[model samples]
Target: MIKRIYPQIQGEIESGEDVLEEYSRDWSIFKINPSAVAFPKNSSDICTLVNWASLENKNGHRVSLTGRSAGTDMTGGPLNESLIVSFSRYTNKIISIGDKEATVQPGCYFRDFDKATLRKNLIYPAYPASRDLCALGGIVNNNSAGEKTLKYGKADKWVKSLRVVLSDGNEYEFRGFSGKDLEAVMARGDLFGRVHREIFRICTENKELLEKAKPKTTKNSAGYALWDVWDGRTLNLSKLIIGAQGTLGLVTEATLGLIIPPKHSRLAVIFMSDMKEIAKVVDICMKFKPESLESYDDSTLKVAMRYAPEMLSVIGAKNIVKLAYDFMPEIWRVIRHGMPKIVLLCEVAGEDEEEIKSDLDRLKANLSGEGFEVRLAATEEEAKKYWAIRRHSFALLTRHAGERKTAPFIDDVAVPYENLYQYLPALEETLKPYRKFFVYTVAGHVGDGNFHIIPLANLSDPKVRALIPRICEEVYRLTVEHGGTITAEHNDGLIRTPFLNIQYLPEVINLFEEVKRLFDPLSIFNPGKKVHGDIAYAMSHIK
Candidate 1:
């Protein structure tokens, strides 16, 4: 049927068992086998496929296009039961790089992009922890963030423009515009103009409601983000599309702004015995304006230690002896401190080495004055050891947990920094009842108050599987009550979409639906995501 309807397609369309099986699962807990997977060679092929899907839907055949890149999404955002449109196969490219920005295809690997930017002493700083495995499309779709987000903000802030193939089967460029530029766009009288005009109207009419619906957390990737579209003067559609998770349209190309990284950097490690002073610790750290503030619980540290041998593959260790030598100080510290309940890594970066070292010295003195075990990394190589644990803890659990697998349902919750003292304990209390079913680890961007709690569960056990919905309900309720968002970086895919209403009022949800219909009237894009996500359907598809 695909060959007949879109015979001009310049890429492969596979429905074979192996291909379908490969596209069935992502990093999330769900498993959904799409009918077929289409790899478009270029933007023209994507437009053709969109037009074909639209025609099929009009002919009483139900089909939709779900855009996917590296398939590194942890919320089932790239999974669909209809047709999967993967870009990594053919559409991957780094088109051009300038002094301040670069244009790239959706499927461009972040690791590759990072290397290119490093040559120019520039970086797209909103990359997630999965930088080695993720693609630009997933990063943009999820509005991704990482350690540097404390200073540089999320993907939405760096995205300068996007070329999206809308439900009308036409590609249009979207960017921020005001004054005569905005009027020129709305005056075109085409689908693009009509879209801008209608969206501007919707935003202007419901400005107060949209403002009220904004999440209080430092970062959010849950809903439509309609509140960020119009700020009275400039209307930026890219903000709405950045975190829409491909529900609005297929992003064929994107131009992202970049920043020059600091010339010198150092790390300050803080070992906390308990959560009693977490809020104070964060407050004190914020005063110094660290480039990155990250934390992980004792469970993650233990996992890293138990899988110590695996560190050689990730941390660039020369040999086991060298690895042990590099780890000797930390090992002795653990022996003396008996393992801290939480480990915080504060990175200070600047143009001058002495200034950064001075800053770290002052930070260490202040933290040590508070009676905390603080260690200042003497070199950049030493800092990598702490980062290895923070970044690869989830990978270690997923690979070496034997019968258990990574279940990231309640991951990516973020609250205000001031509430961490109470919110962290409440979150742990909520998860304590499920300790019998699974063991979990906590890690996140401490500066942004975002945490990723990944549970290792044996899904084969009925009791373990049954705990998913219950845990999601309880934890999400607690998150909302604490004035937080269900997701801070990972968007509302199949896992968190059903729980969006808990964080937003019904009226705002209605506006989200209205925006959905505005861009994807035919609902040919990724559905059941951002809106209309049925909990039953989501739970039934768990692997």
Candidate 2:
């Protein structure tokens, strides 16, 4: 039957007795063994497989096609027991690079692309946290963004074109910017623009519904890109693909925009007396405009210092002038003045070291009058050492909490800068209600008004299900109240489905349903996910 479906393909089809653990689950979250797995060796093979799957609906089997980008999605997207299209071997062809845009297959890794584009000194900035393990397709699926996004936006912004395979077995490439301009020149609407024109007209017709759908903040990876539906009624194709989380269609390939590599970056650590002082520092740092501005709280720093002593050197402030006290020792005065209960790791990128130093000097002078130790990371090695605290924070935090057998939830709850003051106390109060449970760390791209809370709570006990969301609601409501996103970068997977309504309006969710229906009308492309439904049956059982 597999051969009949994909006659042109020359690859193994794991079925029945031959199906193994590899087909059972993805990297994390829910797990489900597919009825069969198709390992396609080429794009032609994929075309045939989807075409066959399209025909299989006649036999009453739902045609749900999903791409496996190194099988690394945390969303249980890869585990589905449907027509699992594995693109492990179809990685070939550079296609071409035109005016800083390059198109490649779904299986390509960003690091590999970095190497491929070295001569041009071009870098793809939307690097995700799992870039080392994730493929281009999965990153595209999640619309992945990471630490670098503070300067360079999410992956969606950089995408020039997308070669997506729809459920009907018809191949449609959603090309952005350039294609639309070309279409305007030719007097025929391009694929993406044409689709956008229709959607915009539909949106204007349904203006009442669209009004309710507008999000609380500028950046959101919640469900569909409902807010980005129109750019002055022009329609943005990139928004549609960014956070759909693969429920929309299968992304086979993408052409991404590139940027020039920065000449130098100066990283510094300015200690704060308390978490309350962080928001003020973050607001100030935003004025300087660094390559990256991040923070690692007491939990992360202490954990890293235990495992890696090199982390002590992350501070890169040029001056530590003691303003008030002439009697106290320099170390004591500096330490006592701004003894960061929360640490701010800020960086400034420029043409050379002198530019970095000059900016740091001015920043220090401006802030030193306010009383801060102002530690700086001078060299690349020093920068790496300081960065170890953040890079290894998850692992170190896990190791420190020995035998608890914990997992990193990696929740992102954010708000406007004004409400930063409201968070610290409320978080303290929320965690207070949960006995024996502890908060790990709270730090993130605060310059952009996004923060991550790594609350270390044991998941096994039933109390967590109730307690976590209560705390989550506290944080999310605060986020909504302050005009922020419930999710910053991480797309809504099985984990965040329940809290969707708290952050979105009734019509926004209805729009999500409309998009889901548009993409997977059969509701078989990783069903019961990115939509609120039977969580226990979908997530807990299949694993």
| C-alpha lDDT (0 to 100) for residue 280 of candidate 1 | 91
Candidate 2 lDDT, 342-400, residue by residue in tens? 66778888788787888887777666777765766655655665565665565456456
Best-matching candidate per TM-score: 1
Best by lDDT: 1
Per-residue lDDT tens digits for candidate 1, residues 143-214, read: 999999999999999999999999888999999999999999999867789879989999989988888889
Off by over 4 Å in 2: 1-8, 15-29, 71-77, 81-83, 92-94, 97-99, 177-198, 207-212, 216-218, 309-340, 395-402, 408-410, 465-474, 538-543
